[model samples]
Target: MEISDSKKRIEELIEQLNKFAYEYYALDNPSISDKEYDKLYDELTILEKETGYILSYSPTQRVGDGILSQFSKYIHKGRLWSLDKAQSFEEIIEWHNRNVKAVMQYNKENADKLPPLEYVITKKFDGLTLNCTYDNDGIMIKAATRGTGEIGEDITAQAKTIKALPLKVDHKGLFEIHGEAIMTKEAFDAYNEKAEVKLKNLRNGAAGALRNLNLKETAKRNLSAFFYDVGYNEGDPFESYIDMMKFIREKNFPIDDYMKIARDTEDIKNEIEYINSIRADLNYDIDGIVIVINDMRTRAVLGYTIKFPKWAIAYKFEAEETTTELLDVEWNVGRSGRVSPTALLEPVDLGGVTVKRATLNNMDDIKRKNVKIGNRVFVRRSNDVIPEIMGVAEELENAREIIAPSNCPSCGSELMLVGAHYFCENTLSCKPQMVKSIVHFGSREAMNIEGFSEKTAEQLYEKVDLKTLSDLYKLKKEELLNLEKFGDKKAQNLLDAIEKSKECELASFIYALGIPNVGKKTAKDLCKNLKSLEGIKKATYEDLLAIEDIGEIVAKCIIEFFSDEKILRSIDELLAVGVSPSYEETLVNDQSSFMDKTVVVTGTLKNFSRTEIKDKLEALGAKVSGTVSKKTDYVIAGEAAGSKYDKAISLGIKILSEEEFLAMI
Candidate 1:
């Protein structure tokens, strides 16, 4: 193609891609399948490669090909102030009265009629605040984080990934837009499904994604933004806050639809209550509601405090937590024989969930939280995870400190402290340990045996003389029907589930073996390093130690697990019962430059995902390290490569860009 034609084609592709992206991400109405989009994107990429004519606005160029060395600072045109918090209805009323008084004083000075004071209430999004600046041409020029209200890290490239964030506005002439960058619940779930590092909450997911220097990583988070205010405008200012929002909406920016105008303090209270009532149903997380004076002139009259706006206040909803007295600590042994403490609490209702017991984490956490018997503690639940005791809410003078158990609760074996936790050395004989192992073996992430529970394991152990892991496969339907809650259908279903679990992946089966310190990731790593169960049985302690993230302790554990006679006997029995596990064969490119290279990747990369890059390096016979060391041959530094980058520089290791690494591959 001619240069002129290539340029035109690039522009056309950019427009077409942007349109599709906007429709799918912003409008939630995808006109074409992802396959169709990928084909078009591939064509554009080939065209760009041939002509060396990638457009600035091209979807392909949205993510910077290279990671940023450091975040650049950008000064805001106007200062961003935090709102004063109102924790109670009375406090909110006091703020409204203060605003009313200020407005009345202004009216008295002007000798004008007193109009009803109005306040605009918006949901206080639980996310990172972003400030965007548009140039005179109405094109987004820069975006920054809320660093210190006056200056922030320049994240224009990363911010562009937020599809709801308009790159080009209709009325912008050097104006600043302030919004909350958030990860919706749907997006968070979808991202976590495949993400190697799972985010704990939506707030952290959104904040971390924006702060990540890798534009591609930020894009993968599927973050959205809701514009709520204009921090600064170069041209004419709106007479009222509502008019300013209306102007922002007119510019095709994403304005929240839940914004309400409260005419009185009663209306404000009602709005707050309504917001709280529906908070659990919202797609995005919100911590509070922001109430601001509607009229800009009234806000000016109300003025500002040292750190907060006197005209506005944030009504923070109390978190779902309650104080309960710690009755005692129960030591429970798990599949790994790790004995963890559970806080037995005085029953309290927390957000409709009855809380009788909560995780104490470890003995160190109990000490740190100052939790003791007879002391009141705070319990908070996040997502579907078990509720945990946060801290001591009230301390009693006579409260006794929790003492570590000397012996295992399930078995009479002596307890040993391994790091922060206590463990039972007798792994197989302990009833709780064996029961937990059986339950975990049948878990969804492991063997995927449906309808398997701890109670069922207990029943099987007590009634069916289930002494070993392989005993689960030997259960007959007639035998299961004899147990409690086991009807004919339930027994058949359990039998079918056991049959189905027999054909699990090798990695899952390895994880189900319940080796100490061996999780899903470690099990998969073992499979990748050893290939099969036979290879695992034959692997030396040195061979196990050579794998990434496998330390001396894990290596010892793996060797001992494979060497145990009981475990070997159980494996033989399982194999005899038609239990066939499979492992995928990985193709290795031995001739690649990356072969035998000690490579460490840090930060975000545009060309490959976190897992994808690691897999690719491993496929090319490269050993990847979690941390930088002197032995590191190449440090593939991406955007926001913080401490690892600094360490690599200090160690005088070679650093490669994404493009450079791709070339070597």
Candidate 2:
């Protein structure tokens, strides 16, 4: 091809690829397959090479092959103000009261009265803060870390790798946008699966990715981002926080879907509770909720403190992470007979719980983290339940190397090395293995046997010689009565619960089987798509990968799990004992107005909770979206609807009140 033709083709491919990326990452929708995307990307690379011309915004420039010698410093166009934090609801109340008082005082002093106190609430993302500057031509010129609020380390090359962040905007002005650069759980797991040096947590994964001198390494992290604030703008100023967010959205920046206007402390509290409830389910981590005054004028009146803006405060959640001394390491065997390392830590209060022990994962994780006894280590309470040692925090001269155990801790069996873990093949005799398996099989999310506990499982294993999951169904009330703490009532209740769990949901039963890399959600997804136990068992890698959220790792795990003869025999034994797993498709209201429509719900609904409303919409076959766009079929607006409602109106989309929505249904 000629140079001119190649250059034109390059521009076309860049535009096409960027649009596809925006759809996939920013909009959570993909128009084409990954294979198709790669094909275009390959063509773009070839074209750029042939013409010896590479545009700044071209997708080819995203992941540079070269490594930088050192990081250069860049001064921010505007100071990035830190938010004051509130640890308790009481503290948040106090902050709100102060804002209310200030608003009243301002109204009394000035001729102009500030609007009723309103705040914009968003998730306080637990990731590295990045500030990106776009020049007059709307091309991203520089990207830097939030260092000292005024000055930052230049990471323009590293930042470009975040496909969610746009390299160019339609706007014709110089501006600075601030966002949290995050590593999603999917990305984190994928990276750690193959990484020689494993990342400790999601926050560290993102921070280390951007700070790395090697651009290729940074790109490998597959960092994502969420833009919230336009710190500096050369164009016309925004009148309100809502307007600023709309502007950010208009520029096709990757903004988080959640944004709500809270009129009072009750609304803020409700939002906090909602976020906390779903925090574990989110793809990324959020440390807290941020509440900022919506009115720009009201913010001006409230002013700033020496360290933080008075108008905005972060309602901090209980600390999921902290540092504590690693006193020792304990090796334990799990249900799968895999021997794992658990760190014995100096007692520390984390997330309101006294944590003395944390999971060290495996020997490979230990070596990669470089954790040792006597070293101060970073510990995190994962999923608000399991305390996990993330990485080494501070190394000491007295630190001793942590060695993997040669034998099983529970049984005297020799440990066999497997991939990144050690396993004891004697699963039948290992007390911890059998006990844990029984306990897991009877847990709430699994078989959900009421009155079943670890103590109960241990007693059954030791006293009654309950050897397998199938043996639970054969348990007589007389057999249970011989165990410790088992009375007539308890024994009968245990038997009843076990009997009830026989007719269980297919998803829950699948979860009870303990497939690696498969969680409750994944199990549910499997049941939803595959529909039956036999179908799931026979599912090929291609079949499993065809389902959403089931990546190659998970697909491989599922295939391997079902391929095991012992597992198949165990499952067969359970099925023979009348353990009938059933799945029923959720019947939607096909006649409802929301059927097959894309709808967005905004603000506070008086009659329905957030979860309730979302459930209702799904039942009505509506695809509920977070942001309002041209494609939105309808927007259900409640009291004090903010940017989404406004955008819906501007786009001439249908708007419905709570009453109207109810009436339609």
Candidate 3:
């Protein structure tokens, strides 16, 4: 009722609620029920409204944080490029109304014989949205992050290493394929354990993984990919939208599996809701659902805005909120033994999953969040990535005290202050340390043992004396399936994967070693100079330092690799298990002059029209754009001369009239 009292209540609510969040959302362990948490969340909301106690820290105030990071800038296939973000059912209906109106404006006779504006809706993945370009021969020419839809960094070399990314496609002509780069839930958790940082929420996790400068770490993360569609195909040869996706998939592109064909907008909306309901269980990441008219001709007629295609719209799911009470804060130790303080809370249901605990981040975060025990908090899930403690409602400042731990809870090791991270130097001996090490070794990037996940690997190592990668090769399938959640199917997949990975190259094998500072590139360089894994055993620090990008710290880590008994034995054991490190020479970089160019662009194009213009311009190499520019060498304007026409004339830039476009052709 009073201001101070309201503040106290809000603070108390924050603490109680955040504890529940930390337990349920972040930890995947819930201690309470949904009904109970929601009641408290409601009470906080009602009290705040009635008491006029608008605490800035109110749980209801904090909505979702940033979703995707800044996309790279690039040329759009069309001049108008803006994406649709649907936050509610009403918004979707509004979009639907607009889209239907756009279609109605078309000729009825043209529409009658045609397939009802076929709409294909696929689950929107919550990962790094990437664009891959392929030549007619199916050879991947370039891979890029979706920069502002205009220009993107050339990540061809890095992209090639992702096993899931298709190196060659069956489809011909210039096509822009779009998809998500991700780490599966199984792999992400295991990696987060070893990296000792709470895995970023999935989308963030995947983005962070993709953008990491060290390709070895990226590879080590076992980043998987899923290709959705050929975003653009200049030829218009594919008569049907389904055919285009099929062509993409036939070429072994990773398409989202949770796709369904819907008959109408109603079906689309229902399907979207259904997909959102099952998103938590799905592997990889999904944020919303994308609906696009299946008719390519209709799509062309429909066209698009600067952001989103007119025929395609994304029905983003709303923030599913649940309430919980913060019971206590627990100091958690990661593989790094960073003492991250977690809020242990009462259980709450979010997105159908029972959530009780959530991440309080760190002590600084705890203080900043100001959520203490006895506070009520609400947590929201964004695309199954991670949950955040939005805010505290009806707090109780003095209700209870939650503080950081002075020592590692997993082990008795004293936690020393190291930057924001609390480090415990206990290696291999600490339970979390030992568990994470075993898990990392068996991780997909390393030995890629199938049945081995972070939890399974930890239990196997501790219970069966599974100490190293060698120990894993020795584990019997029967012995593994006997563990928790290890069914016959999973066990077989794991064993089969392990058997298949018995033969590996120097880069992968070196990456599996878990040595700091040595990644895929460093490993490749090490092998390039040494020629064999065994050569690393005999190489001096000076030899390692001679290689570029290999610093003293990395050289020391490599030099110590031979001296460390466990690492040395791990390599030998892998060799014994028939995992040989084969080395290969790296390819020279490709430098086609037409690679970078900038120019105004527009209109319906013929021939490799866009692609050929791109190729030739790229060859003689020029950059083509949708909009005309001031320094435009050639305004390659096709049909429908619009604003660019006036702009070009005013600028006095040379305009390649359709006649001129044909002449150039």
TM-score of each: 0.53, 0.77, 0.42
Give a tens-digit lDDT track for model 2, residues 31-77.
99999999999998887777788999998778757899999999999
Ranked by TM-score, top first: 2, 1, 3
Relative to the true structure, candidate 3 reaches a TM of 0.42
Error of 1 at 510 (Å): 33
Between candidates 2 and 3, the lDDT winner: 2
Alpha carbon lDDT at 528, candidate 1: 86
Best by lDDT: 2
Report per-prediction Cα RMSD to one decimal: 16.6, 6.1, 23.3
Least accurate 10 contiguous residues by lDDT in model 3 = 62-71
**Order of candidate numbers by lDDT, starting with the best:** 2, 1, 3
Poorest 10 consecutive residues of model 1 by lDDT?
A: 57-66
The deviation in Å at residue 24 for candidate 2 is: 2.5
Clashes of 1: 1
List, residue by residue over 293-334, the lDDT tens digit for candidate 3. Answer: 788777788776666777777777654555688888777666
Question: 1 or 3, which is superior by lDDT?
Answer: 1
Evaluate model 1: give its TM-score: 0.53
Best by TM-score: 2
